[model samples]
Target: MNLSKFDFTRLKNLLPSSLKSLSINPTSDLIREDENNDTEFYSTPRFVHHIDDRARYVLSQFYTYAIQQTPETITLDLCSSWTSHLPENFIGKVFGLGMNELELKENPSLNQGYTVQDLNQNPSLPKFSSNTFDSVICSVSIDYLIHPLKIFNEVGRILKPNGLFITSFSNRCFPTKVIRKWLYMNELQRVEWVANYFLQTDTYFNPMTIKAYSFFDGNFLPITDEHYVDPMYIVSANKK
Candidate 1:
C-alpha cells in the first residue's frame, strides 16, 4: 500500500476521526535509506540548529506552558543534542540521551547528566525507573525511530502518573535517516501518526496537537515580509 499516492485530503475530510488509526505494522515502513548503522550515521557531531530561531522560540514558549512554569519539574530529553529548546526560565532538572557524547555534554540544559545511546539499536530506557520523570520530550528527532512503539512504551513507563510526553518536529530532518513512512505523509498525517503512537500504547490520555508557528503568527505580529518560518508541530499527551 503506497500511502503516498492516496489523496489524504479527501480521506481527512471523509474520515477525519480515523486519522489516528494510522498504525505501523511490522514491515518495511521502518526501513530507512540504507542498511548502515544509525550510530555511524550520527557519529559526527553537527552543532547546527535544525529549525529557525522563531521556531525555537515557539517551542520554548510551548514548553513553558506545558510544564506550567514549575521549577521542580523534571524532564528527559530523548535523542537530545546541544540544545533542548527549553526556556531560559525553566528552572528544572534535565536529563539527556543522545548518540553523540560531545553533543550531550555540551548541552547546558542537561543539568541531571546525560547518556550516550543509539535508541534505534536499543529503545529500552532500563536505567530509568518507572514513573520517574515529570515530562519526556523528543524535539525534532522522532521520525528517525525504527522501533517507535517500544520507545513510546518506555517513555510512558518512565513518566510519572499524569506526566506529559511531548514530541515536537518541524519541516527539517535528515532525509536519509528519517523512516520511510514519515517521508510519505503530509504534515497533518504526521501529527496524527504521533498521536497514534500514544493511542496504540493505551498508556496516554488527553492527547493534543499544537501548531506552534501558526499559533504565534496568529496571536503575535503578522508577517508581511517574505521570510522562511519553519513550520512546527507539537503532539503531546498525558500519562494515564
Candidate 2:
C-alpha cells in the first residue's frame, strides 16, 4: 500500500465519476452488517477448485519465479482456499485464513490451521499479528471484497518490510459472489484496478508489479482425449 500520491482528503476525486453497470447487481455482503453473522461462510464444506489446471500451472511458475526469496519465511495466505501451493522443499510456517474451516481442514498442507472469518464483515483480519509474516498471497479473491483499499492497508500493516504480497486472478469468478465493482471491467482493466487498491492505501508497497501468464498459446496436452479450454491471467505486486 502506497499513499504518497493519494491525498486523504482528495481520495474521492481520483476515481471516475461515471460508473457503468455491467453486472446484474452487487453481491450480498459477505458480512452481515446488523448482528455479527461472521460464522455463516464457514458453515459448509465445499471441496472445489476455482480454476482450471492450466491456470494453476501458471501460478506454480509464479511461486517459483516471484517468490524465490521465501524459504522458511513466515507466510500468510489471505482468502486462502484448499491450497496455497507451497513448494515441497520450502520449510516454513504457513498460516491460512479463509471463510470455511472445512475447506481449510481439507487442505492437508494447511493442516487445520485456518480460522473462519468473513473479511467483508470485518476488514480486521485478527488471525495474524503485525509484522509477522514475510509473505502474503491472496489468490483470485480480490473481486469479492466490498472494501479493498482498506484491506490492502491492513495487509501492509501485518507484513514485514520488503515482504511480498501476491494476488492472482483469471477471467473466472462466481458472478453472484463477485462484487459489482469487478464485473464492470474487462480483464486488463481489472489488473489496473487491483494495482490501485494498493496505491491508494498506505506506503508499505513498492510500485505495483503486474504480470500476465498465457493459458492458451497453441500448446495442448489431452487428458482422456477430451477438449478443454483454459483462460487465465495473473497480476502480482510486492509489499515494501
- Can you write out model 1's per-residue Cα lDDT over 14-104, one digit (the tens) per residue? 1234334565865778898875998888889999999888788777877876774456778999999999999876888899999998888
Candidate 1: give the clashing pairs: none
TM-score of each candidate structure, all chains considered together: 0.84, 0.74
Please give the distance, in angstroms, between residue 232's alpha carbon in candidate 1 and its true position after superposition.
0.4
Q: How close is candidate 2 to the true structure, as a TM-score?
A: 0.74
Which 10 consecutive residues of model 1 have the lowest summed lDDT? 6-15
Displacement of the residue 149 alpha carbon in candidate 1, Å: 0.8
Error of 2 at 103 (Å): 0.9
User: What is the C-alpha lDDT profile of model 2 across 97-145, one tens digit per residue?
Assistant: 8887767877655642777678877888666678887778888788877
Among all candidates shown, the one with the greatest TM-score: 1
Model 2 residue pairs with clashes: 1-202, 2-202
List ranges where model 1 is wrong by over 4 Å: 1-20, 69-71, 204-226
**What's the lDDT for candidate 2?**
0.63
